[model samples]
Target: MIKKLLVGIVIITALALAGVYYAIEQAKSYLQTPLALNQAELVTITPGTSFNRAIGLLVAQGWLSETPYLRLLPKLYPELTNVKAGTYQLVAPLTAYDALAQFTQGKEHQFTITLVEGSRFSEWRQQLAQAPHLTHQLTELSEAEIAAKLGVDREKLEGLFLAETYHYTAGTTDVALLQRAQRNLERVLKKHWAQRDAALPLRSEYDALTLASIIEKETAIASERSRVASVFINRLNLGMRLQTDPTVIYGMGEAYDGNIRKKDLRTATPYNTYMINGLPPTPIAMVGEAAIAAALSPEQSDYLYFVASGRGDHVFSKTLAEHNRAVRAYLKVLRNQ
Candidate 1:
C-alpha cells in the first residue's frame, strides 16, 4: 500500500508539470496573436495609467480580446508591464506583442508641422491652429502677447522662428513648438552671424535676418539666392532704395489685390523698401537658413538689379539699361501670354 501511494504522488507531480507547460504555451500564443483591428487607430494613455488598465481599455474598445493568458503576459516577461504614457498608433497586421512592445518602448505617435520659408507669422499661426491633436494655447492671444510670452520684443517677433518641419507628440502646445523653433533659429543665427563676412554692412544679427527675409521673398530658386543677395548688397552699398515689390505688397497689407500699382511704391510705409532708404523696421516674413547664409555671405558681384524673366527665374543686371530691357522683355512675355 505504501508503494502504491508513492506511485500516485509521482503521477500527480507529472500532471502538475504538464499543466504548467500548457499554460505557458497558451500565454505565448496569446502574445503572438494579432490584435482585432481592421484599421489604424490612435490610443492615448494618460499620465499614471497602469499597464493592466491600458490592456483593459483596448479590450473594451474591441481591439483586443479579454483572455486569461493576457494576465500571464506580465508574469512571463516583467518588462511588458512598463508601459509609458502617450498617444500610440496601432496598425493592423500587428500582434499583441508588437503593440505592447511599442507602448513599453515609449514609441508615441509623432505629428509634424512645417513652417514654410517666406511665410508670414500670422500664416504660421493659422497653420498651428489647424494642426490635429496640438494643444492650442495661442488661439486667443494677440501677436504681441504671444511675443511677450516668448520673451521677445513684440515688433521683432515676425522673423524669429526658424522655418522647418517640427515633430512632436500629442498634447504639445503651439507655444512650446514655437519656443523650440525660436531656440533653433537663435542657435543657427548666432553660429552663422559669427562666421559672417565682416564687410556685409549688417549692423547686427537682426539686420541680417531682415535682409534674409527679403531674399527669401525674392526667389524660390536655389541657385539664385546668393545672386539675389548680391544685388541687394550692391544696392545697399550704393545707398539705393531696395525698390523690392514684395515690401510694397507687405505694406499694402489686405489692400494688395495680386497687383502692385505705381502709387503703392510711392506711398510711405515702414515695410515699403521702395520708399524706405534702408532695411525695413522688421523682417517682412520668415527666412530659412539658406536665405540667412546668403545675406551674411553674398556672392561677389556688381549686380544692382533683377526682374522676372518669365521663365521661373530672374534676369540679373549690373546696369539700369540692362534692367529696363529685362523688365520690358518680362512685360512682353506677360503681354504675349
Candidate 2:
C-alpha cells in the first residue's frame, strides 16, 4: 500500500509541473502576439508619467482596452516601469514585449529643425517658436534674458548659434535646442580656431566667427567664400575700412528696408563696418562651417573689392580702378534689368 501511494504522489507532482510549464509557455506566447490598433497614433508620455498611466491611455484609446497584457507585462518585467517621457509614434500590430522595450529604451519620436545660414538670433527664436513638438520657453524672454538662460556669457544675442539641422525627441524645450546649437557652434569654432592658419587677422574665436558671419553675408557662392574672406583680411591688415554693406544694414536694426542707400552706408554705427576700423562688436548672422573655415584660412589673393557681377555672382578686383569699372558694369546690368 505504501509503494502504490508513493507512485501516485509522483504522478500528481509530474502533472502539476507540466501544467506550470504550459502556463509559462502561454504567457510567453501572449507577450509575443501582436495586437493591431487598427491605425497609427501618436502617444505622448509627459514627464513624470507613470507606466500604469501609459497603459491606461492605451486602453482609453480603444487599442488595448480589453487586453490583459498591461497587467501581466509589469508582473513579468518590472524594470519596464521606467518608461521615458516623450512623444512616441505607436503603430498597430506592436507586440507587448516590443512596445515595452521601446518605452524602456526611450525610443521616442524624433522631430527636426533646420537653422539656416545667415539667420539672425531673432529669426532663430521665431523658427524655434514655430517648431512643432518643441516646448516653447523663450517666446517671452528678451535677448539678454535668453543669453543668460542659454549660459552664454555675452551681451549680444545675435550669431550665437550654428546653422545646421538638429534632431530631438518631443518635449525638448526651445532653450534646450538653442543650447545644443550654441554648443555645436562652440565646438566648431574651437576646433577650427585651433587649426587656423598662422598670422590671420582674427584675434580670437569670436573674431573669427564675426568675420565668418560677414563672409556668409557677402557671397552665396561657395567658391567665392575664401576670396571674400581674403578681401576683409587684406583690408584689416592695410588699416582700411571693411566697407561691407551687410554690417551697416545689421546696425540699422528695424530701420533698414530692402535697400541700402548712400545715407545708410555713410551713417556710422557700432556694427557699420564701412565706418568702423575693424571687425564688428559681434557676429551679424549665423555662420556655417565653410564660412568659418574660409575666415581662418583665406586664399592668397591681392583682391580687395567685390561687387555683384549682375549674374548672381561677385566681381572680385585687386585695385580701386578695376573695382570702379566692375561697379559701372554692374550698374549698367541693373539699368538694363
What is the Cα-based lDDT of residue 57 in candidate 1? 74
Candidate 2 lDDT, 234-327, residue by residue in tens: 9999999999998999999999989999888888899998888999899999988899999998999999999999999999999999999999
Q: Which lDDT tens digits does candidate 1 get at residues 1-337?
A: 9999999999999999999889899888877878899899999988887778878878888887878866677889788888899999999998888888888899999998999999999899999999999999999998888989999966458899899899999999999999999998998899899999888878999999999999999999989999999999998989999999988888888999999888898899998988889898888999889999999889999999999999999999999999999999999999999
Report the number of the highest-lDDT candidate: 1
The 10-residue segment with the lowest total lDDT in model 2 = 64-73
Full-model lDDT for every candidate = 0.90, 0.85
For each candidate in turn, the TM-score is 0.96, 0.82
lDDT of 1 at 204: 94
Query: Lowest-lDDT window of 10 residues in candidate 1?
Result: 64-73
Task: Give model 1 RMSD, 1 decimal.
Answer: 1.4
